[model samples]
Structures are given as C-alpha cells and as structure tokens.
Target: MNQTQQMNNDAVVEVLNASGASDIVLVCEHASAFIPTALNDLGLSAEARHSHAAWDPGAKAVACEMARQLDAPLVASKVSRLVYDCNRPPDAPSAMPERSEVFDIPGNKKLTRNDRETRVARYYTPFHDRLKQVLSTKPDPVVVTIHSFTPIYQGIQREVEVGILYDQDTRLADAMLEVETGTFVTRRNDPYGPADGVTHTLKEHALPQGRRNVMIEIRNDLIETADAQTSLAIQMSRWVADAVTQSKDISCRV
Candidate 1:
C-alpha cells in the first residue's frame, strides 16, 4: 500500500449509539488523535501538535457524553485536523493548513493538485461522506457540530464563555444565546460563522434544508481537562435539550 493507504488502514472514526430513536445528530469534526506516522509528527513541536490547531483535546469526550444524554448518534472524525479540518470548506485556507503554531507543515506546505486531492480523498471526503450518510438516514434531524476554541488568541483574552454560531438557523442560536444570558455568550457572525473560505459540513448540508442546526464553540480551557469536559458536557446537554424542545414546538406549528 502507498503511504496514504497505509495511514488510512488505521483510521479511527467513532460513532456512538444511544438507546432509542433520536431526533438529533451530533458531530465533532476535529475530534481525533490520528497522526500519520510517516510524516513523523509533521515536524511540529509537542505543544503545537497537541494544541487546538491539530485537534480538539476533549471534544470527543464531551460529544460522546452529550450523545448519551440526548440519545443521539454522533459521527466524529478519526484523522488529525491538521490532515484536513473537516470543519473547513474544501478551499478554505485552513482546510489544509500550512502552518499551525510555530511549526511549518512540511507535508502541507506546498501542494500540487494531486497532493491536495490525496488528502481530501483520504480525510475530508470520508468525514463528510459519513456525515452525509447519517443525515440521509434521518432527514430533518437537528444537526449540531461541536467545537472548542482557545481562551486566548494571539495575546488577547476572549471573554465570551460560549459562542453560538449559525448561518440559516438563527432560531437555535438565538435560543442558546437567550439561555446563556447573565453568562458570556456571543452570537458570532462567523465567530464560528462561515466565511467564503471556511465553512463546515453542517453548512453544506444543514443550511440548505433549513434544518435546525448550530455550531457551538466552547473555550478550550473549559473543556481541556476531564473534570471540565464532564461539567461542560452536562451543562451543554441541558441547554441543547431545551433548544430541541423549543424547535419541536415551532415545527409542530408549521
């Protein structure tokens, strides 16, 4: 097998099942520990590769617990986000990032069309295809893509405790913001929003159908540790359930 083929042989995509029929489908595009061995850690520092740029440290854990609480199915990526962020549009600058943290991605630095396609086929396409398959199986299911962001970017501290992002489905975002009042909640135009260059699988599929969806961003500091992850998961589960309840009421009227 070729290098990419060999890497693919051990991909670890995760799908957690809840007991009964579910009205929700959760996905964490950046949840993964998969780093190809051939590239030798992409020549990154231990800190850089382990940081948010490579993957969301506790996102999968939070997502899994939320899935259990909601009785929802979750589809998560198995490859490192550095391979290809499933949350980014194919042409997004960060989709195949050249540099993350202080390390230059030798593998991602310069690419021919074929090289890009190879990564896309191996990483991006599979992640998206799996998401599409899940949605197809359960049309109109509410899609929630979970992610975590750094508490500080560059040198600035972000005060917002949570950022709820949405494009077409403002209902959910608005609801989340309402619940988050007295707390720091921001309705980000693209704080998690989609710009022309970057958008996730949720935008491609959920926005078109006007399916109720939201991209939730919690600060990494709040979820990086096990205790923090569990706390945030429980908090998010309650709020998400409330949002779903509201959505059902609206759907019933329509």
Candidate 2:
C-alpha cells in the first residue's frame, strides 16, 4: 500500500516512484480487480470477479517491476475494469461493458445514463487525471502501458507471447520489436488491436501529446509466477530503455 493515494473515496488510482528520473511513464489501466464495496462485486461470482474480465492478471506486478528497474513513475488504476474500464473512453460501450467474453456483468446490464456517468466521474476521471499529472512532469515523456492477456480466450489458445502495440506512432514499438527477445514470440498487436479498442489509453494520453508510446501485452501465463514477472521485467527494462534512446535520437532529427 506504499505510495498509494486516495484519489477518491474508493481510492481509484495509485502511483509509485512519482519522482523517478526516467522520461518513460508506466501505466497499468487494468491493474486491479477491486469493485467498490457498494457495487457488490458488479454482481459477479467470486471466481468471475478475479478473472481476466475484471483485470489484467500479473500486469501490475510487471509494471511495478519495470518502474523500479527503469526508475520510472508508475500510475495504475485501483478499480476493476468491469466496474469501468479506465483504458476506454467514457462513451465506448466497452468502457462499461455488460459482458466480457462469455461472462455477463449483471451490475452493468441495465445501466441508466446516470449510472454510467457516476462510474466515470468516480473512477475514470481521477485515474486519468493522475496519469496526466505524472506524465506532464516529464519532458517528452514516453508512455508504456503494461497489460496481460489470457492464454485461452473464448476457448481458443493464443501463441503470441508478447505484443508491441501502437496507434499512429510506432517509433517506440518498432524499436522495441527490433530488440531480440530470444525465445519470446513478440508481434505488433496480436491478441488485440485498434479494432478491439485496446489502444484507447494510448490514443487519449500519448497520441494527442505526440509522445512516443507503446502498449505491451504479455500472455498472463508467462508472468503467472512472481519470479517470472521479475524476469520479464528485467528483460523488458533493457529493451524499453534501448528503444527510448533510439526514439529520442529519431525525434531529435525531426
């Protein structure tokens, strides 16, 4: 709970290493599976509440490790995506989805406009505002959002180990892709892409600012263990650092 700040009564966002010197800013939009006590776990079973539909498993651990290794500030959401997806725009249906994969969200099924707006005002705005505040402090900040994908989605198994995703700007993604990852299978937007509304965070925060950014998706199984998260973080830290250096060089010439 260290470095945790109560952005609202629900404590929607938590920041780590806020004064870190790295130009990179780490974000975990799906960092937690906490549905406010009042939401009643979004009417989901305990199993469903802890499932991938609620949050990106192991993503926060990876992001935290990366922040430590990179000396970068990490801003992460403290509420479940099922309550309100921090990565999505307030207008997007998926922002407050009634269903995720095969699981229907009872609490969200019949939401009125007021219900939706309340969630947005209470959860979404504060999370993004904190993220913005962190990024604003760094000159030419590079945004790196960490996420984890289910190995089997809708019963289909995915083979890609890691995904380097970008919207309009690919400077960081491209450079990271060039870094050899040894056995890890990395691609540019494999499990999800812009079509899946996975890049909303990048579009909203980094694109408008013209900051170098990349959304990284790792298979949840890859980081299922704490040791694995740390190992991956160490490797990713090197790759991201190298990529950031290359991106800055490219920006200087532009």
Candidate 1 per-residue lDDT, tens place, 37-123, comes to 876777777777777778877888899889888888998988788888887877776888898655677778887888888777877
- Candidate 2 residue lDDT tens string, 166-249: 888888988898875666888888889988888998988888878889999999999999999999999999999998887776
lDDT, each prediction:
0.75, 0.89
Error of 2 at 73 (Å): 0.4
Q: How many residue pairs in model 2 have overlapping backbones?
A: 0
Specify the poorest-scoring 10-residue window by lDDT in model 2.
1-10
Candidate 2: segments with Cα more than 4 A from true spot: 1-10, 252-254
Instruction: Identify the candidate with maximal lDDT.
Output: 2
